[model samples]
Target: MSLVRLSIKGISYSQTQNGAYALILNEVDGERKLPIVIGAFEAQSIAIALEKEIRPPRPLTHDLFKTFADRFDIVVKQVIIHKLVDGVFYSSMICERDKIEEIIDARTSDAIALALRFDAPIFTYKNILDKAGIYLNMSSEDKSDSEESDDILSTPETFGNTSSDEEIKNTYAKYTLAELNDLMDQAVQDEDYEKAAKIRDEITKRES
Candidate 1:
């Protein structure tokens, strides 16, 4: 399979949902962008990692996983967003143990959450990108055209008017540190790693 390297583009909250967000992944070499609908916690986790945020007193699950990996001397090389099916994106971690490589199935959100912890690259199959990608016309005159196209193609019901970078910063700005820390606790208590991740990110960004 042809691997399509990806990078974090931005994340936008689902305006219609209180606990959901859209995680946008962009192809490294092309304009293809895949927007995955992930839970707020997951969104926060990915965000925190991407933004290089600092954790509060308690370690989030992804953090614990990272700790465990370190304890075991395993290295996460990268994360592969391997597939998209039934409106869900699937991912895997490429890890090395004593020079041996292994692939493990993971929820896209968790995989990304962990990827951020490890400072690992994210990737996907070209076919998956082709299937779920969105393309924006960057021509100056096509602003409205791009907006319309994105609106039509967006997974989450509500689309933010802000550009990608601004949207992420805004989302991170929407919460207070204490509030995010509480949310992280709630997510962990509820066993929602995805939500926990998002909260972690928010805390990280605010601190940074």
Candidate 2:
């Protein structure tokens, strides 16, 4: 079966699902898109990586994994969105150590987060794409010709192709360092370490 490489295009808070976010993945070779519903923490993690934000003293789980991989010379080659079962998409990370490949089961959100951090491609089996893909209207004349270019065989371009960095910065800039610090404290009080890490990272980025 053929595979379709995808790159994240946009992430927005989903009002319908409280604390959930919509992750839009655009096809690398075509005009199709796939939108996945993911939790708030996962959204933050993906956003931080996409924006190249620096984390605080304590490493987040994904950060720790990246550090471990670097320390042991394990290269993350790609992250595969392998299947969708019972409304949940299954994913795996393809890592190479001494030329041996390893497949590790992971949540789609976590896999994507790590994939972005490691500069790895994200791919899905054709079957999975067939099940959940949504093709957007690309017929508008205003659409750039570059959008139709087939570059799936290479690294999927960064989120949103051109506007991701500016959007991320703007989105994050709304919160002051003190506000983010307070959010981090609240997250910790609630035992949401994942959210705390994200808030911490945002604060670090602003302060830096």
lDDT (0-100) at residue 21 of candidate 1? 74
Residue 132 alpha-carbon offset, candidate 2, angstroms: 0.9
Clashes of each: 11, 0
Candidate 2: segments with Cα more than 4 A from true spot: 53-57, 141-208
For model 1, residues 1-208, the per-residue Cα lDDT tens digits are 9998998766766554467777767788997666666776677677666665455478778888999999999988999877654445667899999999999988887888888788898888987776555554355655445444432112321112113445455766777778777766665444333344444444544565
Off by over 4 Å in 1: 140-208
Candidate 1 TM-score over all chains jointly:
0.66
Per-candidate TM-scores read 0.66, 0.66
Q: Please give the lDDT score for candidate 2.
A: 0.66
Candidate 1: how many backbone clashes? 11
> How does candidate 1 score on lDDT?
0.66
Model 2 Cα lDDT, one tens digit per residue, 1-208: 8889999876655444466665767789986666666777777778777776456567778888899999999988999888765345678899999999999988888899899989999999887776555544433653555345322110121111112345446755788777776765665444333344344444544554
